[model samples]
Target: WLVKKTPDRYEVKIPARIFHEYVAFMRARINKGMGVAEDAIWSAATECLFLTSSARTKKDIEDNIEREVIGKTIGKFRNKYRSALRYGILDSAPDIDVLLLAKEIDAAVVANDFGIQKWAEELGVRFVPAKTFPLMLKEYLKQRSSISHSTKSDFFDDFEES
Candidate 1:
């Protein structure tokens, strides 16, 4: 319905490592006595995040002053690429491909990672908060429904007043 209804182009991009992290997170919780709601969240994420790798990872970040402050103040982001290397977020870290895709496409990313969002902003990209997505979507649909029903509702209101 979303793809069909939206009049604009929809493109998908992902960090291979982040994608893997989400996938692994979902898989680990499966059949572990998760309740109905948890299962639904897990299922929704698992189903939606499934992707076929179309490109390899690539990034192009230069160390600078703001990056230093941002890294220290907000959250764990400054050394995200480095930490990815140490923690093996992917088989390798610093997947420039993820950030490069954001830069090249000039699109907003949906993510929970402050690192990805901050760097994306620095690179002239946008990021949508992961938790806020459902609320946004719900409000959008609600508005659409209201508009769709308003014509009939207005006619009925006029008749009732008469």
Candidate 2:
């Protein structure tokens, strides 16, 4: 079976948190002289869109506290157990940023955070496990290299015949 080629326009959207995590992981691999890590880093540099979400403003802090404390308290009294339980699932500003950026760009999220994965699914965003990202990048780069090599060989063959 033939596999479809990845589109040239395909882009990877990454939040700052994931970007840092990926960079650190790749750096370690690169220091060890892993060829796949080299390819992955190059791909990330070219295809990944690194984005930073806004900082948690005063209002956001207040809202979080309200949700964690007052909301949970009210939820328990009102028999809304699920709402109370949801308070800490997305515990940080960076987590929310990942969801927001993915939703805005209609891109898949690569993150290990279970909370992010759960919420991404709820928002109809695609999710890719962080663990497999490097492997995927390696495969993509291999395919790209093979295609380029074949194209170059075919060009040389045509030139020789002419």
Candidate 3:
């Protein structure tokens, strides 16, 4: 598969728990009749690179659940969320993993995760806003185009792509 073989294009990272959560979310979305290209999801997971924060990150995610639901009247989803937040299982994060991925890889994060976007600014990570991607995409594409401008030695530096 392209993802497994070549991670250069779509580098991604996630807390171990959040990774599983993404799987469950994907499952629920499909079950609930949300339409998505399966290949895209699979690529985002299997092909994209992944990472995790400390264990406290998982606890941070669990602690936020009640307040999160209180806002949404998310009645039945509570326990499911805790279980999902259990480390290395679901989309739990002290901060969202997608944002962490953006920070780690310096890649333009393709997500509408406002939570992550908020933290990303604080962390000084650049994010490609999901909803406004088309408007920003010309710049994003321009960045991509310059990828090859870096010679092999320069591309491998520790400073990150940006």
Which candidate has the top score in lDDT?
2
Q: Candidate 3 lDDT, tens digit per residue, 39-98? A: 344334332222232334333433354346332333334445544544332233444566
TM-score preference between candidates 1 and 2, better one: 2
Q: Give the Cα-based TM-score of candidate 2 against the true structure.
A: 0.45
Of candidate 1, the 10-residue stretch with the lowest lDDT total is 52-61
- What is residue 32's positional error in candidate 2, in angstroms? 42
Superposed model 1: Cα runs more than 4 Å off: 1-95, 151-162
Q: Give per-model CA RMSD.
A: 22.6, 23.9, 22.6
For model 2, residues 34-53, the per-residue Cα lDDT tens digits are 34544454444333222222
Q: Residue by residue across 9-95, what tens digits does model 1's lDDT show? A: 335555556755654554344323234444454444333333322223212222343246333432443245335432422121343
Clashing pairs in model 2? Answer: none
Q: What is the alpha-carbon lDDT for the whole of candidate 3? A: 0.52
TM-score of 3: 0.29
Report, for every candidate in turn, its global Cα lDDT versus the true structure: 0.54, 0.64, 0.52
